[model samples]
Target: MHDSSHHSVDPVLAVLRQYFGFEAFRGFQREVIDHLLAGQDAIALMPTGAGKSLCYQIPALLLPGMVVVISPLIALMQDQVAALWQNGIRAAFLNSTQSSQESAKVMQLARQGAIDLLYLAPERLLMEHSLTFLSQIPIVLFAIDEAHCVSQWGHDFRPEYLGLSVLSERFPTVPRLAVTATATALTRDDIIKYLKLQQAKLFIASFDRPNIHYTVVAKNDPKQQLKRFLDAEHLHDAGIVYCLSRKRVEEIAEWLVQNGRRALPYHAGLDKETRQRNQSQFLQEEGVIIVATIAFGMGIDKPDVRFVAHLDLPKSLEGYCQEIGRAGRDGLPANAFLTYGYEDVIKLRRLLINSQLTENLARSARQQLDTMLAYCETTNCRRQMLLRHFNEAYSHACGNCDNCRAPVSTWDGSIAAQKALSCVYRTGQRFGVEHLIDVLLGKKTERIIALEHMQLSTFGIGSDLDARQWRSVFRQLIAADLLVIEPVYGGLRLTERCRPVLRGEQAIRFRQDAKAPIAVKKDVQAKRGTLSVHHHSKELWQTLKKLRQDIARQQGVPAYCIFHDATLQELIDKRPITEQDLSKIYGIGSRKLKEYGADLLRIMKQFAPDGIDV
Candidate 1:
């Protein structure tokens, strides 16, 4: 119900106020929108929760013809289109997930000029029929979401994304926008080449999600540690638990369900119907925790996810950031919790060696893994170290991370480092961490006895440190680049970086491992509400949620599609009575006011006598 004929000094802000109910553009949104509105191509490198969509969406509304958005997943397309419809914007998608009749109707709409924004998966959009159909339409611009997938160096590289370059070739006159959340120097260059955005104006937003309290703990009784994290903060909240394998996903999902949590498993291995059902449950319901592999992340549009925990390490820091970035998308305080150990490293390295990825890709993956390990072992400010990996600088320590919250103590570990390096060297530089640990602890197992006389001079020299402590030293050595995992045999080998330590020319310092379970953010939920709402009355909050849920269920969309929890919270705080006042609330746009404002205001009026304030 936006007034397209209304002319104002700043047309974009007028549209934003009419549609989004927000007073200002976040970060580089207005700049990207300005570039596209000026008939120039652009690239936006923004973080996950950043308003990257608005950068193109606003321009689409003001442009002459419909803008085609190239999205990655079918789930993402459906979620976005549903949300768009709620805001009174005309949007649709075509993919394999839809029936031919449904697709034909959307095509009919496009041909009839009844659609504003149309989304397509890369593979579908690049099809000959799809290209031919677009050629006849009055097309305007192209927006490529998740552009990092176009780069081979990116964590989730998709061959289909390479086909997107044809968009520039086929629609030569149309401007384009390539948007992504995480990309390294190599991936950024690759996106430019693949998307032909070399001449586009680039907008790089800061990658920091300051609201996320980062915490990484060494794996010790992982199940208990996870439970404590849940109980301490997100006991009944919706969150994601990422596992490295499908089996672990299933196991964790089952365990959580058995232990009185609403949990579900999602992975490629699950049958199509099961996967869809689990995903639907996660999106449509609240307080439902999803335990899944990396496969579950790309299309998650849920705004109120309270936490992202890693039971095992991710392949790279890029992947880690993207996954954890799923949390706190609503701009409320959230958490990124991880529990890892040396065993996790060994398993992942071995898997990498056995996988059939190309040699070039394998080398890149190894480097990414090494960087990720080093990050986990870092005792400095987590945010500063993480941002540095992205080639960005943070001038000061971020007090939100675990390292900054609880300053870890450092101690001299030169002797321990020397002993671990010597054991790797003395054992022919071929044995794995377990074997090395056995030798260091002077355990004469059958394999050790057969391979050695138990008489190597370095064999029992490391008995002063316990096995766990010795494992920590080895893990840290790997993190320090002093040791490398032999790809073929999954053994430890010395790197040149270890030479100084071996020769007693350099001293090593290590952070004493924090023995306690994860440190909980005591006032995190209190600062943000228990339900991530700002209201004090739990009863009124639940009532508003129930109303939103009812409307969303009737509309056959996620509850957030009706109005985000943030908007509901504002309704509580503002206690708007009239349509004009309702229009002033965040997320309550003109179209939403026409559609749901009556119901919302009616609900608020009933509770007005209670004098509630969010």
Candidate 2:
């Protein structure tokens, strides 16, 4: 029914409609593609799910030679190449997963100009032989994904990325484009500087993902809190649970499995086989949860991740944004769940202090951490705070985040602040929150008694408050910069900012820790049986998904690679029962029709009316 190739006047639009089965470009996709086509360099600073791939993908089809995509992760490359191949585009990836013979074969295909897109890791592409071989080929363009990795201050910095500038020297005529989803101003500058994109045009899209609902809860009891979150929102849904440590990842995975979930643990600590298997399972199977540390989710391109739950604080907002951006990439409704506390901050700070990073880099890391803390402590819109980190202005409160949905209540805490600061000052300014809370609550702990802190004037002054309440106070104080966590002993120290509060000239108001929010919108679907499909259409949806899974299994590719959930939903809505009908649907280009048209048509025939002709 739909012949997008020959009918369109514009060649780029025709390729997009014929191969990708889309009507038009989204966000800055069209501009970036056109710029690259004109042999101009560009930097696209878009959030995840903003159709970053299409910026390079379309150009690869229109350009003379194959586009060499220097990606960071094997999984990312595999997912992209699979999707492209399924669309009938000649795409291949050369990474660690491939043997020497396979790599040579793919490179041979490139040498003959038989491929449209070639994907590989930066390290692989930067190899001397690899570079020499590539230099001999006619490369159309160089597209670098996750470009923020070039910066030492970036959340997931890879030292190897600093070498990417060689592309400019080697491929002088080829247009180069660098794309990153998470980069603060500093990181953005670093990406530009390191990638040598000085004269490149910049495209910065809004960092807001309107489809994802953001919820951050103060960590009261993380285990139970996570259980409650999963049960209440994303139970039986495909999601990721991020922890700060590998041991915690294993524990959470085991705990989730024990509570009746198909959960897996992923971290660098796991054997390569185990990590690959778990990651493959998460991509191929529906309703699977991955519990991993920051090591797990760099270039994961899963489009239907229903939610991303963080059991611990991510080191920086850049890391936090990129991690949560994994969810809702398909543009359907999804959720982000985070549970954090002051203990996470102390732990992360200690980790940094123990590292051998330079003092300047360490200071940058601490500032990034402080910004992350501000996001958690902010009473304003969470989305606003998140975008602010990227220097993007989202002036209005996005109603999707937890704060806008259910505003938090705050109380004037000037007296509590004075007591907390005084306790820190009197108790030798070097004690951690626990011992200081002990003195304030007048707990006769052995250490407190040994230090003779009970005699201090600040002792017993905060007895009216419980330990939990006092902990919250101190946490807020640290967040407010009235106190700082000293790196050496992980103890609390008063800042000059605390002087005004101590003098009663400045009043501090701390947010009353709210309970885990019970936010359920019928419009935002996180789990199956919750998506708003009509009763009759629900059966068709399940049938379509089953067909996709079956085909994906036979092909040994991810089901989403075969057909995204959005594409299948469109199929159900259109009820295409013929090649013509199917081609008219989005994501069903001429190639996809040839590959999957008959299978889809046969499936929809089951739902056809009894009296209607087949």
Candidate 3:
């Protein structure tokens, strides 16, 4: 076994090796499992790729009875159960997708004590029949997946989750494990309170996904920008492109397909069958891109997604983190690129203000929007800014994000900010950035000429910079919280926060993106070394991937289910010769070793004859 702990192979490590085919547990996995195995409740705040499921799944294997997982969506449940089933674990799910006959079969299996793990949607679990049925079974534990949904303040709150507190009321003795990939302290507290987890041990993993290079660009010709990024960096990789609306998802997916890229659209607006087909296609096929809305990627378990690009602004920092977390699951390098424009911000503002959200919720939503906007406009390390939002402290620059890689240059923009603020104020703050910029630059546009704005003292004052530079300045000012776009008028308005800078009481600096078009070099992962495959291992790696793909097709499962690209990379790097060596590979659990060990060994010897154990 791979030595996870320094001690000899203990029971947990033995289970890990026999089942998951690994030597050791990662980070807090062992700690969380130990706590749960000791019959204590726990909450794990792990990142997307940090193996949160294993924390509960491993414990479930060791426990006496079946583990019940409260998952959010049917697709997510199916993927997780399929992966477990591939690992030779008897896992099943109950969802709307199942007929009454199928559901009854699964329930009968549960009653007979046959299933190791059972996944259910929250609504299904809370049903009177469902709860009564569970009372008859030997339930070892309850694992609440995506526990953040229980928080009303969270990005993806579900009303169905609020009823989960009854689990404590009904099964007071059963251990409960609540897990989420993204949750702030507030959301975390809400989850603990709502779920009624009694003195639950808290395990918070680092929110950093170091392998994903974060980049935010100004939204210029959005579809073209998306196309260029995909073509340049992820032409042959699997990825997701997130849009704010169903229409945009369909249009972008169609555009990608028309351009010879195999892309599919996913949204709540699609028929159930179509959505399931698109999601399955995305997960089961390699190099397939899914153009989707926010509704698509909450609990997807695919591990080799190469990138996630956003065509518009996300409503909250939590939402942004959760969406981008979908990439780089197997620890191979991935990329997250976000494109935001002035209209995106305005649209979000309108959504928050005009929606039926309560007063406090609206305020919180606005605050979240400001934080996300600041993230988009930051001149420092994107990773640092992102971690700080989650209350995780990173003392130095990450050196992995686009800002740290390119090192943005800055110039004194106090005068420019004051001039911009004055232009907005003198122009009555009722006009948007275009009219304001035209007036500032003394343009002879129809609106400017018709409004007679050329007569103001601030008119023609911003001649030192071009219109594009002024636009950047305005964008930065808004990001800095010095200005806000009114929801009703969609016009520029100065906030009280802008007073100090406008009055020359404080100095402001702006990033000069003229050096690079706000878009960094597309080869972010190659530079990071995580995605940089060695030349000697390249051929073998490709061969392993081909074999895994073929096996996946044969099994009717996603290629990552057979083996993730990261796992394949390790196979090439290690060049394992014997069954024992194969058993030491991270993702090669005992079941997989027995199933494909001979084929893998044959392939290894065929490609790397000199390294074989003859």
**Highest TM-score among the candidates is held by which one?**
3
- Candidate 2, after superposition: displacement of residue 299 in Å? 1.4
Model 3 clash pairs are 2-23, 4-24, 21-589
TM-score for each predicted model, relative to the true structure: 0.94, 0.94, 0.95
lDDT against the true structure, per candidate, is 0.87, 0.87, 0.87
Q: Quote the positional error of residue 558 for candidate 2 in Å.
A: 0.6
Task: Tell me the lDDT of candidate 3.
Answer: 0.87
Deviating ranges (above 4 Å) for candidate 2: 1-8, 519-530, 608-614
Off by over 4 Å in 1: 1-9, 444-453, 528-536, 609-614
lDDT of 3 by residue, 85-135 (tens): 778888999999899999999999988989999999999999999999999
**Candidate that beats the other on TM-score, 2 or 3, i.e. the better one:** 3
Instruction: Give stretches of model 3 more than 4 Å off.
Output: 1-9, 515-530, 534-536, 609-613
Ranking by TM-score: 3, 2, 1
lDDT of 1 by residue, 1-614 (tens): 88876554688898998888887889979988888888889988999888889988898789878999998888768889999988888999999989899999999999999999999999999889999999999888899999999887876789999988898899898999999998788889999998888899888889999889898988888888898888888878899999999999999989898889999999989998998888888988999999999988885789989899999988899999999999989887888999998778888888887888899989888888888898899999999989998889998999888888888888899998998899899889898888888888899999889987388877778889898888788889988999988866779999988988989999999978877754455565476445545445566788899998999889899998888878877887788988989989988888888988888888888778565642
Tell me the TM-score of model 2. 0.94
Per-candidate RMSD, Å? 3.4, 3.1, 2.8
Weakest 10 consecutive residues, lDDT, candidate 1?
A: 528-537
Error of 2 at 229 (Å): 0.8
